[model samples]
Target: MASKQHRLTGTQSAIYLIISITLNALGNGITVSLNLGSALWTASAVNLSHLVGGDLKLLLMLIGFIAIIVNMILLGGIQWRRAINNLVFMIPFSILVGYSATMFNQWHLDNLPLVLRIVLDLFGIVMIATAVSIYQRVNILLHPLDDFMQIIRFKFFKGNAPIAMWVSFIPPVTMSLIAIFISHRIYAINIGTIFSLLFQGSLVGWADRHVFKTLKHQGLDKLMTAKHQ
Candidate 1:
């Protein structure tokens, strides 16, 4: 059985889910605006979007769906209930990402200076890291990729967070490499992707330890606990 202390009420979970998805969308928008590629999964989706001439948001939805299916298979059976729960947030997440991408494209930030672009990229990365940390703490329905990573980590890595994160990078990096080879150029895997691969885990780990600790100290965790009870 799950620990009552770690479980959240429906309302609390909904609030955290909205915050996590919103931050994720904001990060996606900033990354798109930077024109410097995105973190691993988004970079893969971007490359696929280029290849198929499809919208990035639609591709993300498809990718997320596939991830869930794959995860279900890996776990040895389908759990329709769990899958539906995941899709509840996944659909909104895709929509938000798409909307944010459109908004950022309309902003014309691509014409900015290299320094400004780099700064925005860094900011986006921080937002994404922070969002990921919060999502983990919420302990509710997670993005499929994140869910898959957690499953793999515990099953194979003995719950080693850092190693799990690094291992999770392999698939997207492989996809990016394939995209590069096919295009004979770099489309979505660039400096930002490299930076994410190297530093995102450490950044998220730090945020989990310090940033979220601060939030807990401020009584957010207590509120969730109270509501849950």
Candidate 2:
């Protein structure tokens, strides 16, 4: 009976993956088209309120919360694995990356050549790639947005992980590009902000590698399986 149940779970997971993949493709196509406007509007609003003095940390936390909500709405549900990994990793990674970006902003280094800034942004891209590579290996839950995309791919492309993977990455990539082209007194595209994404990616990877990795390595999965039985 236990074995049969296990098999059933696997089947459900497979079905979920298929649905997620197809849905993701469609969702992403729309997100890409719509996100630019959203980004501009968001930036504009932030700029408009520049005169208001408030707690920057509170503001940023709100932004992060909004990002999470947006991802949830756009993707439908959070991927359990991704959420777990993010929780485990994002806290510290956010601190480091966020701090670094703040430092860069305060450095008054905007006067530097655009070429140098581009190089920094490239470094951030590399960081994002590294995080993606590691997280992919972990095979954990996808982020809400990723899970949604996964559903799309599964539905349309029949569980093509590769396609789902690419689709999941498009939003951040799009944001990066938009950031590069658009600039304002309050918000301009900079390598520091883009590189900050790497921190998010890295945090996800860290959680996968550390927390979940430890659980699996400690034979916790087997224990959980037994418990479920």
Model 1: residues >4 Å from true position, as ranges? 1-6, 49-58, 214-229
Tens digit of lDDT per residue, candidate 2, span 1-229? 0121222245554444334333323322222222222122223234433434445445444544545555444445543444454344435444544455455556544455766645544443434433333333323433334334434444444444445545555654554444444533444323344333334344433433454232211111221221211
Over the full model, what C-alpha lDDT does candidate 2 score relative to the true structure? 0.39
Q: What is the RMSD of candidate 1?
A: 5.8
For residues 46-161, write the lDDT of model 1, one tens digit per residue.
87678667898788888889888876765666766556767886777767877898899898888888889888888898888778767766746678887676566555665455
- RMSD of every prediction: 5.8, 12.7
Task: Report lDDT per candidate.
Answer: 0.72, 0.39
Worst 10 residues of 2 by lDDT: 220-229
